[model samples]
Target chain A: MDTPIRVHGLTKVYGGGFRAVDALDLNVPRRSFMGFLGPNGAGKTTTIKIVTNMLSATSGRAYINGVSVMEDPKTALADVGAVVETPEFYPYLTPMETLHYLGELRGLSSCETTNRGRDLLDLVKLTDWREKRVGKFSKGMKQRLAIAQALLSQPSVIILDEPTSGLDPRGMVEVRDILKQLHKLDVTVLMSSHLLNEVQEICTDVSLINRGRLLRSGSVADLLDEVKARKIDVRTLRPLTPDMFDRLRAVPGVKGFAVTGDLSFSLDFEGEEDAQARLLIELQNLGLMVVSFKESGLALESLYMSLIMESR
Target chain B: MMEAASVVNNRERLPSDLQQMVTVAKYDVLKHLRSKRLLGLVILEALLLGLTFALPLLLGVDPTDDPAGYMSAFVSWVEILVIIGATMFAGDAIVSEFQSRTGYLLFPNPVKRSTIFVGKYLSTLGIIVLMLVVYYGVAAALVFAMTGGGTLLSLYSMLLACAYGAAAAALGFLISSVFKGSTGSLVLTFFTLFMILPMIAQLLPAGSIKPWFVLTFCGHVISYIMISPYPTDLVDSISLGNGEFMEYWTYYPDIGGSLAVMGGYVLICLALGMYLFRRKEMVS
Candidate 1:
């Protein structure tokens, strides 16, 4: 199969004896939207940097278009576009100048650069402010411009590191929509983000990492299946008293329970959906409370915590 | 995911490489040409030249009495222009990229770093040279109209002086590439070309240095016309009051020496500048 990106024995060490990334192996198929999920300080940025040819790898190889990043970085990165970490742009130039400049650098003809630059500006919804100097742009505006610049080459693969780290709700939704549109164009996207909900929303596949090591990598559905099924959060109007909480845990199908806060307690169910029904009845019969009951599918926050805690 | 089999099956090699390099160079030249600071510096030099040569002849000095004497005054005017203009022009040719944070935008392109160094440096030099030529033409016309003696010879001397100015500008450009800040480079260029070189000539024993040192080094190269009026007795004297400065001093450039000095300064400084530029991590 034609993989857009493949990593083998990838590792990185910083100056002060810190092994920022251990020997890690990864594969990303072409045209797939893959979420690179990792907590803070988990080497996500380092891996993206190495893959994009920004940082040299200590002892590994990342390949793009079958070209080795280590052996021939220029060609290996020829078809890859990336915005690793906070995007930086020349503040004095307008978006059009910045995009056209990059387009020319990538060998686009003047006509082609102008045409493509126009289209990319429209795509990022910055066509109106194309002439405004980037220095005066808001953070969201800059991020949009960065995305425009990244897509100017129409590369097969695009990597973004926490591309939505500091955006308002509207900005986040806008960026998410842009990612979806890019996916529809068949660009293989490898995005690193700590926001689990954002990842779960857009990624078809995911690779979870923590503490500089890979915890799991697979299709999101398959990886979620591998995670130990956990408690279901039932938010209700009244709190379940300490005694009622214990009795709910004693329900035959229920294995254990943990109260997240005052109104909700996560009750672990061992069996199938029928067991979930049984717990609901027992709680109703006890006249405790039942505002709402639903299965919270593998809350990545808890999953991340459990994985790290269990490994330690 | 696109089938890996299909990707491997459809891989094709394209036959366009030279086009890429030309595209990069074209855009870089365009961007360099649009720099207002560079253009502004060039215009400013042109105005100063007009004020120094045309205004003085029109308002104050007499060139008709002694055609060569007026040419001598023109030599001093050109010297100040060369010193000030070269210092300003060359000092920011490289440092401004860093200050503007546009260094990353230019350096990481498909073009080789050396292409950028030569392309931008040469273009700036060309602009500076054009300014000098314009001033030279205007001054020669004014001198011809007034004194009308040996006009061709006077113009020949002016061209020689401009050549020396080009060398000074090149040397100053090299210093700009070496230093991080434009102001520091400007001050350094002035000190090296104006104060330091002349100071050394005065401090060194007579005849200990070569004739080139006494005849054509530092500002003396451009100001040699003003010194030609000096008789032999005042040739060795330090004062310009009694000295009859020649419009042209016939000391051929120690080509090897000139190359050695300029090449050492240019290549070494440019190498370090490229190294620093390449090593920059390009943080915004």
Candidate 2:
């Protein structure tokens, strides 16, 4: 199957010799919600900008489907919906007007534009404020309206840059819920974000990057399983001593441990679940008051941190 | 609920470039209509019309005696008003797309940059034309009411005024394409058209260089065409006490010459502006 987005050796250098994106390569498969994970100033936005033809690539090339973005953007971008950075619309225009304008530009008939625009406005939950000027809207409202605009064309692939950034808790959840709905609908989504938990929840596949370079790209399940590590938290009824720490370290599967408190500590165990059970038994065998013991699920946060640290 | 799968599956035929251009122009016109600037320009036009009628009445000059002279007088103010409309509508059209980050929403659409530029230019010109129609319509009605008839010179003057407005709008778009900020482009457009070019025309010795090279020189034809026996390139001389004569030449751009200069400006500036706009990256 043809990739919805493909980049090879894509490099973008801003003025004053700053390489924002350096020889980056990426591929987003069709019908996959790929999380583009990166930190601040990690060239995620730059790469999206180039793909949208908002910025010219200094070297190399990017393509949407089979068309080159730089050489032929009009045709290449015809089937693409994008929200770069934050959402900004013409202040004087209402959400309805904004969507109609964009929809007509994308070649929908007036009737179709109206019907689809109404549907999109309702989908984004902006139907109540459809006629109100966008200037009075809060940032989250604008972001939601931006998503509505992006989906106006019914694009095959959607590229969003930090869709949930700068939102309040409720706003974040609202936007995440919309994204979840999009995922269930099987829309090909490539969203860039630094929120590890958000990606872990919404994305099926992820590409982790730092300093404008790709670190890892695969299914989330495979990546978490490949790390072969688990964080096991244990709590004791009473304060432990140095002797107990030595005895805990002597467990066969305990690769590392940190004493979070006098009566509590967490262990990094690299083993199967049966071995983990054995380690739990051994902890009790060491004559410690092991009040509670549980193994934390593998987290994308640790994998992201480890990969970023390794790359640096 | 709208089916996301159905919408994604049903793809309509994309409109041609010309159709898209018209769509863009229509929406841009809607933007202007909703903006206070259009209302402001209309109010300014009404004020100019008030002056046009009140000035002649205050001076106790019967326009019926010489309708062409009245038109010539009115054309001067009309030119100024048209130029103002041009600058306001076109001066920041392109630059604002970048400065305000509206391009982030706009540039990703399926339209070409050239299409966007042309659409904006046409819309700005449309507003200017609309303004001129009102201004000239008032002028024509006033002349016909006072004199019992209208002169063909008014028609020629209106045509010249429109040509001048289009040229000025083209110049504004060129400035907009060069500057990254709307305020700078707008200020510079007004300064170049009103102050700089007029200053050059005033400082240069007439007959030395044609002054025809300046946009303001072509602008004179809008009023000059209204003159009954249109002025020629005759230099006026006044006698000084010391027996030396100070020469004053009123440079008149004949109809053909004025058309050529305005046409040159419209063609060159629009071509250059579109080229620059096409090449410009939305860095902001």
Candidate 3:
């Protein structure tokens, strides 16, 4: 409750028994960039919608800066800026005019809103199109504009759902760059994304969920440590037969194995570099010519997959 | 060029409910101004006013000998203006927010849903008021240019027309809140107010039973107020040549009773519409 954002026992069962979020509890620490990672139906967007007070939960409470979102949403969301999904603005309005309307609703003065809105436009790289109608904008452009609006109030907490989902590679980098600035500003950021590497790069903490249930929540460093037990892919100069599969499985600290290619296979190993070195020696002792041996994917991605699989 | 820290210390108080409502309505009004529907209303008004002027000049049918009669000719289309204005402004007010997915940006704000609804309602009524004032202003000027004296009954008729427009807009908002698509809501609102209710009003004519409670029936006061004492029900028997007779009658609404009926529709529809809007969730 004392955190910048806290969701406790939140359950949202939509009409027709679709349980979008179930007893989902989460806390975003102050000044921490939290990555809310989940699969397609993992209730990430639902939780964001509830915390932003866009959708009502079936039961339980979500608080912003200790203010209850349900009991007093206006106060709870005063310092919270969010983009829950692919948000669309009025096509008739230019960026500046749209900002005026929203800024007025948020009790910002005209001069202040204009000045801040210009800054946000520049931050999102949209200052050139401030006077143009939003109707002509592409999806990526709108996504950037959405980010700008979320930061217009200089909110203490920022929630973004797939902020870079529709962007080109350059646009994605630009948005990520803006996000990096938020880290320096010390804004509590809760961004939901399927891009694990991006989360690994920008987030300090993460809470992964699956099927409306929390799988794991901790700092990115701790999660990486949990996944130091990595999946190492090994390649050979010759094809492996059944007897070789048996000998490969017999190695110490190798928990799982899958044949990725005719001459290559992946092993789920359980140790640091020292254990990896011993496994390489054991594989070479099996009398196969080793070609390549390396970690397969990112540490957070491995942790995300293992936790999500375990939850299922 | 923009300083986040400079504004961080300048975060003022959140807006009051009234201020929020005004903010919402202000943009909604801007939307109306920018839309093609307002242009459509303007065209409708110009056509109606042009007919009023050209008919009097071309056909030499100047009823300006009597001020009420001349003004009645101009005010005859008042019902259509109100109905069209309601259809244009209020018909899609609530549904467009949902259908077009604008609710995503608008609904999650710190502003309450009730405030948004009231703001939109005021915006609709505001347009209706402006339409009535302009249409009547043109009509009053034309009537004055023709007739030497002013028409007092036209003023009462305009007042009734404004009330009737408000009730119509309220009903339109109710339909908008209940429907999913803008086209269906707009069509249904215009059809229900202009076609269905008036057709039903025909069945319960003045002689036997009065549909005094019907919103469209009450809307008759906007025009019928010009008729002194509001002419009583006329039941006439038509003679078929072979001694077969058919009965037909005309219906007119009383001024006071019709105003009361219009007021009732406004209160009921406004309450019900606002309640539904507040309870609605932004599903998309």
Instruction: Point out the higher-scoring one by DockQ: 1 or 2.
Output: 2
Docking quality level of the chain pair in candidate 2: medium
> Cα lDDT of model 2 overall?
0.85
Distance from true location, Cα of A286 in model 1, Å: 5.1
Mark the regions of model 3 whose C-alpha exceeds 4 Å error after superposition.
A231-297, B1-12, B60-63, B234-249
Best candidate, DockQ: 2
lDDT of 2 by residue, A1-312 (tens): 458799999998888999989899999988899999998988899899999888889998898877899998888888888888885788889998888888888877778778878888888889999999887899899999988888877788889999999999999999998888786554678899999889988888999888888899988888888777788888987766787777877888888898889888889988987898899788878766799898655468789889999988
Error of 1 at A129 (Å): 1.2
By summed lDDT, which 10 consecutive residues of candidate 3 chain A come out lowest? A178-187
Q: Sort all candidates by lDDT, best to worst.
A: 3, 2, 1
Q: Compared with the true structure, what per-residue lDDT tens digits does model 1 show for residues A1-312? A: 368789888998877878877887889877778899887888888888777655567788888778887676556655666766656566657899887767765665568668778887887899999898787889888788777777776777778888898999999999888887775675788999998888888888888776667887878777666555655878877887877766776688777887877887777766666776877888888786788887775556566667767655
TM-score of each: 0.75, 0.92, 0.89
Task: Calculate DockQ per candidate and list them.
Answer: 0.18, 0.54, 0.50
Each candidate's iRMS in angstroms?
6.0, 2.2, 2.3
DockQ value of candidate 2: 0.54
Query: What is each predicted model's overall lDDT from 0 to 1?
Result: 0.66, 0.85, 0.86
Give one digit per residue, the lDDT tens place, for model 3 in B137-196.
888888888887668898888899999999999999999999999999999999999999
